[model samples]
Target: MENTKQQKTNVSSKTRTLVSAALFAGIICITIAYFLHIPIGGNGGFVHVGDAFIYLAAVLLPTPYAACSATIGAGMADILTGSANWALATIIIKPILVLFFTNKSKKIINTRNVCAAIIAGIVGTVLYMIAEGIMYGSFVSAFVLSLVGLVQPIGSFIVFVVIGLVFDKLKIKEMIK
Candidate 1:
């Protein structure tokens, strides 16, 4: 019983440490993304650093941690740019993808994982498109919306794949465990 209690306490402490690290790392990435905004597709946004953090969180952290990291990370940029509405959708969607898709004990960043990540990104983008289109009619056409959703995921996949390769070569995969 004492050993079990000690083990539980260690797990709890480790979880807390990872969660705090993710939160802080998320904030840092979001700040950099804000300063270096790169727009893609009609409504899709892009960033170099944001993906690194998201992919890392998805690979290393649990669902809740990944979700919180994505929400706070990307949402921070959206909030700062006076786009509170966009921030809200990002907070909901990005983390859901990271969490749901990365549930198994699998590395979340790799060539194969990038393919899975691409599919997940499309799902996330489509979700945002549907929600935003319904609320604001921001999409000029359904076709355009479809294209935007597809293109962004493809772009993200390509970018993250490259980043994943770099990280893999550098043996960052070990860090995720």
Candidate 2:
């Protein structure tokens, strides 16, 4: 009887943890995406720091939770900002970004993670540019204009490094244990 109760409790605790992580991470992602951004390149597109949170989610949380949060948050941000047209692209691209760099056992700045981050950034930028090219009916402006959006991925990596260090310094994983 006691063993059964303990097993149930463990499952409940894990469920709660996953649910809370998803909700909080999603909220943070959406808020960052919608409320914070920099316009550039004489085009209507903007660069936003929401990817920082997406990367953080991938680094710190389980992959499914992180992927869902990133997709939902960025997609919702697009909808709320009247760029609903980009929501589908965001949902697809952001999850791929998270999946590529996620390595819970590795340090964020390690050779593996850094290489992965650079690749992820390139993938993200290229995918977004492709989406924009399709939307704009001109590949040239989309490519040229979206180049500035690279700042977001670069900035995201920097912020990820800072947050990753802080989380490491604080022994954040131990807190869960």
Candidate 3:
């Protein structure tokens, strides 16, 4: 009975911690995406470091939690920043981005994650092109315009790798788990 009670307490504590971490990650996503962005092209599109946090969240949190964090964070940033047109697309794409990543690995910068980042970047760019094409009523134009979107993933990959290295060195994943 005592062991069971202790287990319950541990579960509850872990739940709280995860919830808080997700919320914090979401906030950081919003902040980085909204405030620290470089306007690109004539579209209201911008490149930001927010995806780095999304990648980090995917590496650290469970899939569901990471998806939620990425979706809410990226989606909310779009909505709050008057890019509501992209909000729906972001909602759909961000979670998909998380699917390419895994928190199962002990090291954050493993082969799977490296490949996942590259694949996620390509997939994300393609999805954004499709979304923009639908919105603009021109697939050709969207494809041309969304070329700038590739820069985001490249930048995010750099940020993720650098940050991931620090996190791995510090054993942050083990500590959190």
Considering summed lDDT, which 10 consecutive residues are worst modelled in model 2? Answer: 102-111
Candidate 2 local lDDT, 1-177, one digit each (tens): 999999999999889768866775666556555645766664446788778777767766777877887888888777776668778888899889888765466454556666667788889999999988887788898888767788888987787778778877887656644
Candidate 1, 38-97: lDDT as tens digits: 554444444334544565566656667676777777777776655566777777776776
Clashing residue pairs for model 1: none
* Candidates sorted on lDDT, descending: 3, 2, 1
lDDT of 2 at 113: 61
Write one digit per residue (lDDT tens) for candidate 3, span 1-177: 999999999999779767856775666467556656877666667778788888888888878888888888898888776678788999999889999988899999999999999998899889999988888788998888668667888988998999999999999988886
lDDT of each: 0.62, 0.75, 0.83
Q: Candidate 1: where are CA atoms >4 Å away? A: 1-32, 39-52, 103-112, 138-146, 149-151
State the lDDT at 32 in candidate 3: 53
Which portions of model 2 miss their true places by more than 4 Å? 41-44, 106-109
